[model samples]
Target chain A: MWVALSYACWGISIVLALWMLYDWFKIDTTYSEEMLTSSREGELEAVSEKHRI
Target chain B: MTIAAEPAVQVQGDRVSLLRVLGPAHVWALGVGIVLVGEFTGWNFAADKGGALAALIVCWIVGLLYTSVAMIDSEVTSTVAAAGGQYAQAKHIVGPLMAFNVALFLVFAYTMLEVSDAILLGDTIVAKAGVEGLNHNSFIAATIVVLAWLNYRGVLMTLNVNFVITAIAYVSIVILFLSVSPWTQGAVLKLNELVTPGNALPYGWIGVIAAFQFGIWYYLGIEGTTQAAEEVRSPARSLPYGTMAGMITLLIAAAMTWYVCASLMPWEYLGITYYPLWDAGKLTGSALLENLLFIATLLAALASANGCINDAARAWFSLGRDRYLPTWFSAVHPKYRTPYRSILFLLPIALAFAFIADLNQAITFSILSGVLQYTFMSINIIMFRKKWPLGSIRRGYTHPFHPLPAIVLFCLCVVTFFAIFLGFGSQLIAMVAFYFLISLWFHFYRYKFVRRGAQFTMPWPKPQGY
Candidate 1:
């Protein structure tokens, strides 16, 4: 019975992991554009400040 | 409002290099946990019981050859730094048809492998728990769904989990080896058995070759570290280093595990059962040890399965991005930054195979498809060297011998392909037929349907300064 439960748990864990991965990917891809643009702006600002020095 | 000229908007590429995305330890963990266990268990089984010393020698040679080819692959990636890795290289140096074929084979192979790993995990759990009449199919199906869910979350989460799981797996192997050590009654042959011939090649040279071919399946995802190159920090250096480091770590772990297994049990006893490692653990005379080993195997399989899903989803994303398949596959979730569509697309395929196919059939199909893809990638290295010559300075890692190992791997791949057909029977034929039909469908879809009377040309980038 323990073995059976282990098998079930193992199966369930994988399904849970997959669901989690999906949600993670969804979040990453959705915000990527905004994140990329903001990061670029920050870099440009840093570059301009360095040149002013 | 004055109609002033709009401020120039500078757009920077959001793409990440492969090295920046991967830490050395993360790469090491993946190499040890994900690649090693997946390749080693079955490899040692074939080497010790099925092919004997000849098989072991052949595999070592193959391993070295594979390592060399991987080095060449690093050079290719460094030069192009393209998203698709092998697929991109094949298309650029060869043609779209070849790239499409390689991509399709890779996706199918990895998908089958993920299901197979899940099934093996289920089996290990069942064995340890001493469970009878377990529905293997349902268990596998459930596991596939779980794996899909994990990957759907994102790469970072998967990697983080993989790191923990890999640590557990290493500990398990160590405990298993130590636990089983007391069982040796001076009966375990050491150096002598390395060369001693027995039923190891039960079916003679043909069988030995076939076993070694199947054994190569264990090493299937070693190149996967390269897949994450876009995320790594300094891909030119790190990609090659990470890849080689991962391979070396896996080789050591595998050799250690195999040596321990060989030292603990008689070859004859090892050959009698499929779950030999678990059996060895049971000989420790401690129920707790048995349970621990079982849990460890499950964790190893889980980590491997998770890694496989991540690799497969990314490959699918690359395929879609390159317009090789439907554009929807390239769809990243607006919020998640993940290839949401591709992950969703792969779940059903993996789950269907897990539930529908028998375990052995699924494993055989996965191995055969993997061998086919590896063959192409190995050959592509040699082809690239000749077609696109490097200048005086070697930028990235170069293969030690210019074309020798690559040539040998190519030959080995061909031998393995034929051997798989002979050993695997009808499934081999079905897989080949499936791949060819998929290729034809893609070709037609691209030329006749999607392009619709437009001329089909190579998807080559315009030369700089043109």
Candidate 2:
């Protein structure tokens, strides 16, 4: 019975963590800029040329 | 029109085409898939008796530190984005030999883990079906065959399958938890007991440290998602979020599960053989619910295997592309557009390990290799910070205190390296010796045969501002 209960709590915890992360992403739009520079001039062109399909 | 000769290697190129393969959803699925595997295996139990609370805290801290590293990886991949992610990054940052060593350790680690997951999948399936005297080797072989087929189909197909499997895994875990929780009689919820060391370790700061070391395994493949950075759409945005989200979700779920298990059941009853969650389901409900939980375990094992295989193939593909291994290993299927040769090579190694070894030995080898990889990654990040300085790419998610967490993680890794020796005795020594021998072979082959008397060049261009 305890084992079942514990698993339930664990499940709830996962849901909550996912929720928090979602909110964190929503609040900071600029967070993506540091990791990605696609909008910058010459960068996208360079990437396209390098990885031509 | 002038006739042009077709290149012998159609897929052999400087960069991978992101349009043909991966996207944000695939990236998210891969990250979550890796985390689900860690959680499904009763890895939380490994952290249980050894100061569970301390381990939990350290896991969160480590998650933050890894976030920084993930961002770094994202930045690096953007600049030199290729199919061979880590090997390319390592070669660019350090040198060819160092990159080769890192890639070698990763291949050994990931291959061992894939085999271990396959064996566990067989165990889960057999036990759930109430089948006795099942041919374990045959089951392992079959599982590897199925996994290899999935790999052969290509990344998009693999990702789709992974998405479905992960969804089922998440839903089942939720159902298992909800169904069992209502029946608990007197489950005492005490957080204090987690800190008090008992059978797992002696009571001291070292015990706390030891607990953290074991707990790190639960978060082992968190950074693996970064290997797919180049494939993701706008990786600068998706990579950090996906990696951190996956890890944070895993952390919370693991702690909650640990607490529930520790509080609800007596320590003696929750033995190593019986899965605590499944046992709880049996106690609370009918045979049907028990069967459901059993099926859930099977699905979890299968998903975990899939995730491990994907990561392992990518790592080796990167190595082959960097010319650290035989060039043939870099072959991608013409139609499928996946790392076919690398996947084929990995299967035999994984299958052999699965058939010959028991779960404990396989896990030990995997964990040891993982430790080496993590240590090297942490050191590389520090080196980049020092040497690159102003030229180092900006991080989307930075560790709160510059270098402190990195230092702490490094120290934890060093202690864990020693702990493996102490904890596992002769096995640890044998593995380390084997690793050194492999490293020695690479050194000789590269220096004596390939680049004789040439000065060793670091993988990446030296930063101008350093």
- TM-scores (chain A) of the candidates: 0.55, 0.51
Question: Compared with the true structure, what per-residue lDDT tens digits does model 1 show for residues B169-210?
Answer: 777777665654434534432534533456445567766666
Clash-forming residue pairs, model 2: A6-B260, A35-B236, A36-B236, B84-B318, B91-B459, B92-B459, B92-B460
* lDDT over C-alpha atoms for residue B331 of model 1: 56
Candidate number with greatest TM-score: 1
Candidate 2's displacement at residue B2, Å, is 41
Interface RMSD per candidate: 10.4, 16.9
Chain B, model 2, TM-score against the native? 0.83
TM-score of 2: 0.77
Residue B263 error, candidate 2, Å? 2.8
* RMSD for each of the candidates: 7.7, 11.8
For the second chain, the TM-scores of the candidates in order are 0.84, 0.83
Please list the residue runs of candidate 2 whose C-alpha ends up more than 4 Å from where it truly belongs after superposition. Answer: A1-53, B1-20, B42-80, B179-208, B268-271, B286-289, B391-400, B447-461, B464-466
